[model samples]
Target: LAAGARGLLVAPSWSAPDHPARYEEWVTGLPVPTVLVERLGVPGGPLDEMDRVRSDHAHGVLLAVRHLFGLGHATPLLVARADSPTAQAVRAGYARALDVMGLRAPLPVLDSSSAERHPVLFEETARGLADAVRTGRATAALMHNDEDATWMVRRLAELDVRVPGDLALVTYDDEVAALADTPLTAVAPPKRAVGRRAAELLVERLTTPGAEAEPRVHLDLLPTLRVRASCGPPTSP
Candidate 1:
């Protein structure tokens, strides 16, 4: 409150599962006009109420699930951080996509929290993941990020398993995915556009605080899936 700041663009995601959401408290308490990135609005509510530059993660996850299923991979195991709001949203999208596609059996949402804890993922975690795949009979897996995909591939290699040939993989974030040994099929958001839009919103709010018809823009940028070798060739020979 004492800081000499004009405005703020925050990305304080929602709470963990079964936890209370604190967006309302934070937004109400902030002194200046603010905008939240990625996600920052209630359902069916006014977009201008809280300026934002949101990413449509739900739809992006749907595209990933559909892509895997279309490529003849039936069993999809979703791996994510247990406490991330983004992960929770992805899980919901995964479930919705499967249901809409009429898939009778629901896939598992694996916990990859270990990825964030130990800067370097542990061996036991990898072993446990491999075991989970065997136990769950998963043919394909979606990682929370490209880093997890790389870690899983290395761990699988140690266990004499190979990606695509053994377990097809898809990951989020295409930033560094192409550099992976096998290259990764990833979902990439319009990162630059997102940042630009968020900044623009803050600038607009700062410039016009009392205009009755001021613009209230809430954009949900669409993300694209970058296909590569990780999920294998699109068609079988």
Candidate 2:
């Protein structure tokens, strides 16, 4: 809508590393001001003038994963799409959290992006969970998002594995699915605040032409954990 009206293009984080390069190409011919939120790296040239706000996605992941580990889940698996910055951040945080707990070296981390390429990714992931258990790789798994966690739950049931009994789960984003099924343990991001701040910054830039302000704006929002039945005492059997 903004682009059509010859207005500013204010968008959220592309999340993927390759997206920004493509986005830059798409807006190359346009004369409108473009603002990107939560970008990972610094921009170049005039595009570098675009405004940004950084959130503490890494800390958020760490907080949630640490909480689960502290609750006695020694081996927790992080489930995410392969090669995604969000996934990388979560994995890094999970590793750091485990280190702080005095745990041993890293455990298994699953990437679902590889599943997207193969026709049997879903089935493969479901089948892989059995191996995860047999190898004692992880007693709990933290998904990149709520959608993946929900899918994992269904797959576990199909495999005759009881949630929290056989495997505990956690996810980012406290979406409807998280609350729908006996309350899913999640790390809730400040989505609404992020939106509001992004809009406010863009609008401010729009109103002030050639204003001398910081080229980069970073904002880190603290994440809160929503504990539910999905995670219980590790010895609850």
| lDDT winner | 1
lDDT tens digits, residues 169-215, model 2? 77877775455454678887777777678777767766877642546
Give the Cα-based TM-score of candidate 2 against the true structure. 0.77
How does each model score on lDDT? 0.72, 0.66
lDDT of 1 by residue, 22-89 (tens): 34565646777777787644555442367778778877887888888888877577777656667777
Segments in model 1 whose C-alpha atoms lie over 4 Å from true places: 1-3, 13-20, 41-48, 104-106, 115-125, 132-136, 208-215, 233-237
TM per candidate comes to 0.82, 0.77
**Candidate 2: C-alpha lDDT:** 0.66
Q: Please give the distance, in angstroms, between residue 218's alpha carbon in candidate 2 and its true position after superposition.
A: 2.0
Enumerate residue pairs that collide in model 1: none
Over the full model, what C-alpha lDDT does candidate 1 score relative to the true structure?
0.72
* Weakest lDDT window of 10 consecutive positions for candidate 2: 38-47
Candidate 2: residue 190 Cα off by (Å): 1.3
Which portions of model 2 miss their true places by more than 4 Å? 1-9, 12-16, 19-32, 42-49, 83-85, 88-106, 113-119, 208-215
